[model samples]
Target: MKTKFNTSKFLAIVFIAGAITLSSCSNDDEDNNVVPELEVKTVEDLDGSQGPVFFSLSTGTAVQESATTWDIKFNSSNFSFGNGAEGQVIEGIFENYVVAPASGYSADDLAGIGSLYTYTGQAASGAQHAVLPTPGRILVVKTHDNKYAKIELISYYVGNPDTNSEAFINLETRPQSRVYTFNYVVQPDGSTNLK
Candidate 1:
């Protein structure tokens, strides 16, 4: 006897196959929904006159990309006067000094000696905004006293963006006022050198 293929059986088989295919596809779509996120390095403050103040970057804060500028802010109170001079000395009097430390002149007694000076000037506070250059490196220096005296390091560029490096400051105390000289280097990963 010859067996006949049933149309209903064929239709049922087709339906089951289509359902299985759709289920597998749906699982793949779910997997694709997951997105990878970028990892950012943490920033730590180095030691200053008072010593190192340990702190971490704010969570969820965006990492400045290469070729882009970023602004970082510090409290005015954080800065200590460089022992070099409180104010300015008089004209033609090299020996005289203004606002000397309690003890005799020592290397560490001066400002910008072992640590960066925390500038408390209006210009310094105003210039906190920064722009990230390609490869992304920036150096900023600021100087200020508790009162009226203040100095600022503005949009100063020195080297390539790829190497984000630490900037240096040469603090010179003059009779009229104090002067700050800024220099910068490129960092390895093209990030700001937080010294």
Candidate 2:
């Protein structure tokens, strides 16, 4: 018995395969560039030894720290705060307690301060490089390799083991007071604009 080639069957198979492939490709648009949603890193347990603790923020990574690296207090009131070694300089008055942004706010946008770590208003006296409870301050930091980043302060209090599940350090005074939690994004090319 000789088997004859079926043109209709071959054409139907090709058409179905082509349709399937085309449908799959049609679902996605190649031209629309997507910006990744950066995260709000909760950095905790900072060193309270009256010095500058340096770190980097490249990809909006979360930070939870305890020990500090440097030994100089970088006040934000001056232009040349930390010289060059340290990257970030934060200074502001503390609230009754620190908290995250209310809602409907983009952490990526830094339009209010104009530039990173540039304060708009003066905090009260006894203000240092501590995280402010409200979202009115921006901390400008240079990465270990000289990359610039802006961190929005979220909170400055430690979380209780059984309650208040925000971002916990260990305590709320002195050494633990130096601890901080905030959201941050890095500018790889050291751009002045944060957004």
Candidate 3:
């Protein structure tokens, strides 16, 4: 009339549950090697001269996208870089007119470039803010979905370095560009504002 506790079955259930939980822990974020830190790399020989060179954050490839298709454009001024494409709007916050390598700072150092962007400057005035490329300038882009990415203009005209036209930039995009990595963000909370 009385039922006995099944320790063996109970242990088996717990083991199975734990395994499932651990297995699910691996998300696309991990499978794709996408971390919270910036996806750092240097892309050279990129010409943002005539029209903007289309760079896909999703695939990390630069293609010739017409005015109708592009992510960021390079101009003689600040408008040379930003989220100027479709999908998630990319915003740029002027960090410093002086460009410095992330390696130059301590691991915990977040000065100058440690701040967040609160304004979505007009696209017309987007990359239009002229900045002196001498010390090199750093722009923190609010990538798709308001996610953040920091980019430094290493050179505008290769080797000797000129302003605009052919430029090489050092980029540290965060997480992953996703399908169009630079084109979108994965915020499920539907929260469009960033603090």
Candidate 4:
């Protein structure tokens, strides 16, 4: 007896082949030039806090202002705070360091330093606490009257856990040594200012 062909099996094979063909054809239409969207979330610190506050400086301008966030464009990598004694000192550098204007000043201008300043009080009622330790001391050595100058933190130590933490800020300079003090300022945004 002649067996009836299994139509369903044939149809299944045809369907499978058609699906593979369509999939291969459609894949080529995908544009490789299309960039995938990246979702970046801000990570909080270990203390359930946000990152440190940042400030931006105006190039060739003496005036500076506080910023909620810093953009790469107006700020230089050289303008940074050095790690404290606990942290390793950068190679070929001293532990305590400061920045001065590259030009338009004499050796005296460079010689005269200012105190580094930082905040040291409890968080104000409406102020946000900083994740990083604020500077509590400064040593400034300014010899001449204010003509033109530029300065920024290169690195510093935040006090140890056993001791109270402190940050430095330049206040003024004396003849023998730089007279720096640790002082804090309440900013308009209710954040502490550490110069």
Which numbered prediction scores highest in TM-score against the true structure?
2
Worst 10 residues of 4 by lDDT: 82-91
| TM-score against native, each model | 0.26, 0.41, 0.34, 0.19
Model 2 lDDT at residue 97: 17
Instruction: Give residue 78's lDDT in candidate 3 (0 to 100).
Output: 27
lDDT of each: 0.27, 0.41, 0.36, 0.26
TM-score of 2: 0.41
lDDT of candidate 2 over 122-149, digit per residue (tens)? 4343333333344455555554445555
- Residue 180 of model 4: what lDDT? 14
| Candidate that scores best on lDDT | 2
Which scores higher on TM-score, 3 or 4? 3
Prediction 3 global C-alpha lDDT: 0.36
Rank the models by TM-score, top first. Answer: 2, 3, 1, 4
Model 3 scores worst on lDDT over the 10 consecutive residues at 173-182
Point out where model 3 deviates above 4 Å: 1-37, 64-69, 78-136, 160-195
**In candidate 1, how many Å is residue 99 off?**
50
